[model samples]
Each structure stands twice: as C-alpha cells, then as structure tokens.
Target: LHCGTGKVSYVGGNSKSPALFISLLKRLKATYRRAKTITLIVDNYIIHKSRETERWLKENPKFRVIYQPVYSPRVNHVERLWQALHDTITRNHQCRS
Candidate 1:
C-alpha cells in the first residue's frame, strides 16, 4: 500500500511468506528502477532474517531494510495507514475466503 508521501509495503505470515517479500521486491524494482537505492522501513520480523531473504538482500545491494524499534508502534508510519483503513471500513465488513 502507498500513502501520499511514500509507499508502505509489507510481507506477513510465517516462512511461507517469502513469495510476498519477492513480490514486494519486484514492486520496488519496478517502482524505483531509475533510483540509485531504495530504503525500506520494516519491523523486526523473523522471516526477514531467513536464509532466502538474506541471500536476496546480499545480491540486491541497492535495497536496504531499516528496522523499527521493538514495541514502538507510534514510530511506524504504516500503522497510521492501518488506523485509517480500519476507520474507513467500519462495520459490516468481512473478509471472504
């Protein structure tokens, strides 16, 4: 997802979520192909430290992860997006599988 100022992307779940991170890298590449480097702000999620992810990062020198401090939701701007999304979709909302 993207806020007006900058983009906010994420990968969730467990080790099975590598695909999400891969997709996010693709988006970052496409979105900032001409830029020198792309700075990514993220939480300290364990999957982010997986061997696969580490390998990908090792090869992709242009990409960097800036980890947010633990337990500090207020420092995460992406949480603002979640708050806004929640406020906008109040009541009668359901996730259909």
Candidate 2:
C-alpha cells in the first residue's frame, strides 16, 4: 500500500517464496518508477530474508526492507487492512474455490 496515495499493489500466488516476494518488489518498483526509494515494512517471514531475496536486494539498492517485531501485527497498517478484508470477504464465505 502507498502511504501517500492509498494505492495498493498486490499479487497472489499458491505460496510465498523468495521468487514471489522478489516479483512483488519488482512490481512495486515499476509502480513507483519515479520515486527515489521504496521502503517496505515486512514481518520476519523467511522468504523476506532468504538468500534469493537478499541477492536481489543487493542489486537493487533503492529498495529497503524494514522488519517489524516478530509478533507485532498492530504496528503494521497492512495487517489491519488484511484482517478487515478477511472479515468482510473470506470469513465464512461459500466460495469453495
């Protein structure tokens, strides 16, 4: 999510992997091409710190990742948004997909 414009950039996949996370970062970089830097607030998910991701980050110096406390979801606004999305759209729904 963009802090200034409230615009969200997201992509879904079967599972979380360093490749997937890197793809998301690429998408974000493309989305905000004009920005000098992109800072991501992320949890300590293994993929975020994986070798592949670290390699990519090393090549892309403009991107920064800040890890929040391991168990503190309240400090992340995106977590709250995700919770609301689950409550409204996914919880007890009958999609069966």
Candidate 3:
C-alpha cells in the first residue's frame, strides 16, 4: 500500500514458491517501475528465505524486503487492515459453496 495515497497493490493465483514470489514481485515492480526503489514488509516464511528468493533479490536491486517476528502479528502493520477487510467482507455471511 502507498502510505501517501493509500493505494494498495494486490495479486494472487501462484503457488507458494520462491519462483512464484519473484513473479509477484515483478508484477508489483511493474506498478511502480519508475520509482527508484520499493520496500516490502513481509513475514518470515521459509519460502521467502530460500536460495531462489535470495537470487531474485540479488537480481532486483531496486526491491527490498523486511521481515517481522515470526509469531508477532502486531509487528505486521497490515494486520489491522486485513482484519477489517475480513470483518467488512465476510462477517455474518452464509456460504453454501
């Protein structure tokens, strides 16, 4: 999300692997291709720290990733936004599918 404009960039539909993560990062980079750099705050998942992920980061000098504590939900700034999203979208809903 852009702190100044509240612009959020989101994407999905890839497997939980470093290669897919790199693809997602590329998509995000496309969103701000002109910007000098992009800093992403993410949780410490195993796939994030893999050799493949490291290689991708090495190749992408303009992108940076910050990892928070493994078990601390509060450390992630977007947690509140996510909770609100669930409450507003799925609360009191009946799903038959």
Q: Which candidate is the best by TM-score?
A: 2
lDDT of each: 0.70, 0.87, 0.79
TM-score of each: 0.71, 0.87, 0.76
Candidate 2 versus the native: TM-score? 0.87
lDDT of 3 by residue, 1-97 (tens): 7777888776554358877777778888898899898998878888778898888889999988888875566678787777787799868986554
Q: After TM-score superposition, what is the CA distance of residue 88 in candidate 3 from its true location, in Å?
A: 3.5
Taking the tens digit of each residue's C-alpha lDDT, what string does model 1 give over 1-97?
Answer: 5445655654444445656676678677788799798777777776566677778888888987888864466898776777787788744686553
Worst 10 residues of 1 by lDDT: 7-16
- Model 2 spans > 4 angstroms off: 93-97
Ranking by lDDT: 2, 3, 1
TM-score-wise, the better of 2 and 3 is: 2
